[model samples]
Target: MGSLRFISSPFSATIQDLGREALAYYAIPASGALDKKSLQLANKILGNPLHAPCIEFSFTPGKIEFESATTICLTGADMQFKVNDKIIKLNSIVGIKSGDILSGSWPKLNARCYLAVKAKLDLPNIYASYSSYPNAKIGYNSGANLKKGDQIHWKEIPLNVSLENIKVDDKPFCESIKIKKAPEYHLYSKDITDQLIANEFSIDSNSNRMGARLLEKIIGDKFPELKASVPVLPGFIQLTPSGTLIVILQDGHTTGGYPRIAYIPENELSAFNQNAPRKKFKFKLV
Candidate 1:
């Protein structure tokens, strides 16, 4: 048994799994990793379950130390990191021992990353999830952000588990995210729709797990009232009354007051998280 301790970090980091499903009826959010694929790859590298407790970090100056032997994997944002003075590769597994220090810095180009260990974090689960839901404070770690001197203990696993290298597509999500027109897509004028699909927008500072607000605003005629609220998924795109377009993320609200406009495909939902604050993205309506 070992304890994982955080020595330093610049951004709020939390423990997240695949997320709690079928609980939205109680107004719970299905908050989990924004990059599900990367999380899966990390767990796979250490032979852990696809949906295991993993650490997800925001902007970093991330540093951690372990007090026992454990195998771990890193994926998603390619922050510059070194384990014991040796630079390690993303999407690869690395072994560590007691008092081993791992540290990293967030680069200019990426926004998030995942670090999955062979064993699960001993966290209190809420609504069948081990994820930190900041809005609800469901996870016991209180938004799950690790602070200086905080300790994270992992559940015991067999010591003989093996590690393996995993090959990942160089940039599986490089292309523009695919979208399907929503029920109210036709409400906006042709000029609005044209601008929506062809123009590039930057993620704004207002972004969080709940949703991303884009920098570019729709300039055409104002959209008419959308009648009533409707169910919205993680990728739901809605144009606000003032023309602000927001892209929903993993911690997004289950229903939206604005008119739904587009949705990222389910298979590619996790890939979109790479479009972090100030990052630009174009869209194509399928």
Candidate 2:
């Protein structure tokens, strides 16, 4: 068996794959990697399954120590990973030897990064998935975020072998996020709806995996309200009574009582999730 130990962990580090399926009936959120594109790319570079479990490091992964030799790849935000004193390029296959130390600084452009190893992570298969749902204490390490002194085990892969490095693009995330009218889009007045599509919104600092709250407010003291809770998924934009707009994310609740003003396309959710706090963006209505 092979393993990696965290010397110093990031603010939010969790084991995530594509997420669980057919569990929404029980209100289980689809807790997966926020940047799905980067996660898949990292796995692909390591010649692993597209949905292989990876460590989703948010903000940055301070440092890690390799307990066994293995090949790995990093994707998403550029944290400038380094092995010992040598810098490692992102999105390229690199081999690690026992006692090698990996470290990275805070990411500059995006919010999260993915590290995929060539072997399967020895995590619990809850709901047939390795994704962590921390609210319910559901995955590896009892669904707790990784911290210093923590180690993760994985099946051993061949060592001391040459691996082909894959060429990946510098910028993989989308530049603009597009949204479509939701079921309750007509509930708001034309003026409010226009502001939503025309004005730009900045991400709130309080935002987390559950949702991305926008800093701007469209409605005043009063707005149309949903009579009852409705099924919501990732990317559903909900307008709260406080006039704040929040886009539901991968770990957001299954049902919401707020007005679903607009919905982001599944393909665009990755781009939206990568937007850092206070990052300004305009939604293009399709």
Candidate 3:
């Protein structure tokens, strides 16, 4: 098996695989790639299993040099990507030979991006996952983001490699995420609930994997002083005491103290995870 040596990994970059599902019981959020659908599709395009290891870049661009011939794919943000100074398109697979230089630019549209080599990477596994949970220091390179001069390993490509192009629809990225009324939904007035569904909200700048604060429409509420810590999930819609709304995301805490007004539909949680600050998002109740 040949390894993909990281000549340089940009700040906030991390090599991750699909996360450990069992760890969720311990309240460890499934910390992996934010744009999972895009990651899986990129792997599928190169005949790799859907959950194969890939590089997840956050906000910054990355650069690497391949030591062996390999197939690769990039998805999610339309960050300016180049191989040996030649620009490449996003959401498509490409082939690279040894000694080739791959580089990417800060995203122009989205925040995160996935880079999958033809084979899986070798890293320490915790509970059967190579995903990194930096807070807990579990799995991969001290469970922290990737840095310069780190070495990564990948499985060898099978000789019977078959090539096929997989087309991905834009629906997943553009569709509105749906939500279901949570137990606390009734606490707010009908008008407030209506505003939540009808108004377009912007992603707050103070956002990260832990959660996202929404610049939502001001909905006058009767209980402005409400503050009760409660259990929360990836899509929980929590309301702060000051009437600000927050949509919990993938790396969000297992429990929260705010009043969870509604829960974003499970299927759409991924949509919210990848949205950059200032991007407009609307919701629909299922």
Predicted candidate 3 versus true structure: per-residue lDDT over 1-286, tens digit per residue = 7656666767477756666685566888877667778778778777788887688887765678888888788887777889988999877768788888888777755677888887767778877777787888876777777877776777777633443546675444443668899878887888888888888887887776778888764568464344555678778888776778888776678877778789977666657666667778788888
lDDT of each: 0.79, 0.86, 0.75
Tens-digit lDDT string for candidate 1 (145-246): 667787888876654544444567646344477789987898778888898888987789778889988899988665766677888888889999889998
Global CA lDDT of candidate 1, please? Answer: 0.79
Q: Estimate each model's TM-score.
A: 0.93, 0.94, 0.89
User: Sorted on TM-score, highest at the top, how do the candidates line up?
Assistant: 2, 1, 3
Top candidate by TM-score:
2
- Model 1: CA > 4 A from native: 159-165, 172-175
Error of 2 at 76 (Å): 0.4
- Between candidates 2 and 3, the one scoring higher on TM-score is 2
Candidate 3 residue spans exceeding 4 A from truth: 5-11, 159-165, 221-228
**Clash number for candidate 2:** 0
